[model samples]
Target: MKFEIGEIVRFRKKHPCGDDRWEILRTGMDFKVKCLGCERVIMLSRPKFEKSVKEKVEVKE
Candidate 1:
C-alpha cells in the first residue's frame, strides 16, 4: 500500500480517545500521523505503521 500525505487510515488498534482513524502527516522512513479522535500527532516506523494499518480510507475531499 502506498501511503501519502493527507491520507486517512484506520488502525487495527483503537486510540485512547476511542478512534482508530489516523491522518498521515509526513511519510518517509517514519510516518507522522494525527489521531482523528483527539487530533494528537505521533510518529511510527514504516514497518510498524504498515503492520498496524487496518485499512486505507478514501478522503472525500
Candidate 2:
C-alpha cells in the first residue's frame, strides 16, 4: 500500500499501549510512525513495516 504522511495505519499486532493504530510521520527507506495510544514515535525499516502493517486506515476529514 502507498503510505502518505499524516495517514493512519493499522498493524497486524497491537502496540504495548494497547492500540493497533499508528500515524505516519515519515516514509521512505525507513518509516517513522507514532503510536495512537501512547503517542510514542518509532522508526521501522521498510521491510519490517510492510510485514507489520495490516492496512492503511482511511480517516474522514
Candidate 3:
C-alpha cells in the first residue's frame, strides 16, 4: 500500500463527522490524516492505518 501526502483515502469506517474520506498529511511509521468532513487531524500508526484503509481515492494530476 503506497500512500503519499495530499492523497485522499477512504477508510473502512466512517468518521465521527460521518465521512469516510481522509486526506493524507504525513506518512511514515505513523500517518497524519485530516478528516475531509470536519477538517480534524489525527495520527495513527502505519499498520493500523493500513488496515483501516478501504481504498485510495484517485487524485487528478
Per-candidate TM-scores read 0.93, 0.91, 0.93
Q: Which tens-of-lDDT digit does each residue in 1-61 have in candidate 3?
A: 7888999999999998999999999999999999999999999999999999999886626
Q: What stretches of model 1 exceed 4 Å from their correct place? A: 59-61
lDDT of 1 at 50: 97
Off by more than 4 A, model 2:
59-61
lDDT of 2 by residue, 1-61 (tens): 6788898999999998899999999999999999999999999999999999998886535
lDDT of 3 at 23: 96
| Model 1 error, position 9 (Å) | 0.2
For every candidate in turn, the CA RMSD to the true structure comes to 1.6, 1.7, 1.1
List candidate 3 stretches off by more than 4 Å.
Answer: none
Candidate 1 per-residue lDDT over residues 1-61, each given as its tens digit: 8888998999999999999999999999999999999999999999999999999886635
